[model samples]
Target: MIEYVARSGPPEAMNCPAFICDACRQQVVGAGIVTWATTIGDGRSRTHSQSPLYVAHKGECGRKVEAMLHAGYPASDGWIDLWDDIGDFLKQLTHNATNAFTDDADGEYHQHRLEGASTNGRMQ
Candidate 1:
């Protein structure tokens, strides 16, 4: 099915039928949001004839589905797991940025300024 962003009109303006989100179980309707469809099983073990279509809110349910697929997990109830994943991902990003900063060694001297700073109860 063709998925296009609806620039105007109501949320339920889409001609397609509404469906519940696989992640949050929320009702998704209309053309503005994202539409998802997938076929179940591989042709090797099982036939790919089984296919299911769904409509979802792009920001909420759509993100959850994308994260689940990226992390290689089935859609589960609640957003706690997704939140945890996001937290971890953010932590990694911080770590990587920090590493990048530290890794940059220019010709300029990296000075540890202790002037006017108190150290061990005495100003250094």
Candidate 2:
């Protein structure tokens, strides 16, 4: 339930058991770095309005558990949907940071630079 940034411990020092799901909580089955990015503005507005996200690492969105850990939130004691964790992340970031986001309601979903982007016009 507690996270430790050890200076002299395991190499990766995987996150605590609490930050993992029931499927992998007890094991460090796979390891990879988490990534995130935030963007702001809709329509024509321009500004930094979002925050980096660690939605998934190779299709694994462990962010929900990460956010909970960051806020000192304990595990739910039951299974939780990934989006529910996303909802919690959204609320926490909205309240804790000054960044803001807005949707243009133009049938378009926005993405931050890290939200699957590439050098060319084609999406990654």
Candidate 3:
């Protein structure tokens, strides 16, 4: 699995190590986040937790990634910009809503099971 983390600093501060965008292949400097992925093998997987595999693109390429998300491009396409605050907010909202539904379903299932058990005992 690959994960991209966002950095708060500006692009110029990222001088020593830089990230390149997988979509546009542009060098990412400054405020962009780093991405790390594990290399999968037949038996064992090599982890790149210490070393970043790619640097998220900022500036023009970053803009393009944001545009892709706005244009309905899927995150699976590697064009989704997760660093944006708005996107994170929306994701959180969706997660919360899903959790609420799951909670409701679980409550209903438990209630029905309890009712069924009580009725079964009484009939016996």
Best by TM-score: 1
Candidate 3 structure quality by residue, lDDT tens digits, 1-124 = 0224444576544334334564465554445543322222233242211112233454665565445433443335332234533334346657887777456654432211111122221111
Q: Rank the candidate models, highest TM-score first.
A: 1, 3, 2
Report, for every candidate in turn, its global Cα lDDT versus the true structure. 0.40, 0.35, 0.39
Q: What tens-digit string does per-residue lDDT give for candidate 1 at 1-124?
A: 1234334466646554344455665554442233222334344564332112233455767676655443432334111222223334346657877676556576232322122222332112
Who is ahead in TM-score, 2 or 3? Answer: 3
Candidate 1 residue-pair clash tally: 0
Model 3 — which ten-residue stretch has the worst lDDT?
Answer: 109-118
Please name the candidate that would achieve the greatest lDDT relative to the true structure. 1
- Give stretches of model 1 more than 4 Å off: 1-17, 31-54, 73-124
CA RMSD (A), model 2? 15.6
Q: Kindly report which residue pairs in candidate 1 clash with one another.
A: none
> Candidate 1 — worst ten consecutive residues by lDDT sum?
77-86
lDDT of 2 by residue, 10-80 (tens): 66655442222322333223442333333344635543332222333223435543553333322342212
In candidate 3, which residue pairs clash? 10-30, 10-31, 11-30, 11-31, 19-55
Each model's Cα RMSD: 23.2, 15.6, 20.1
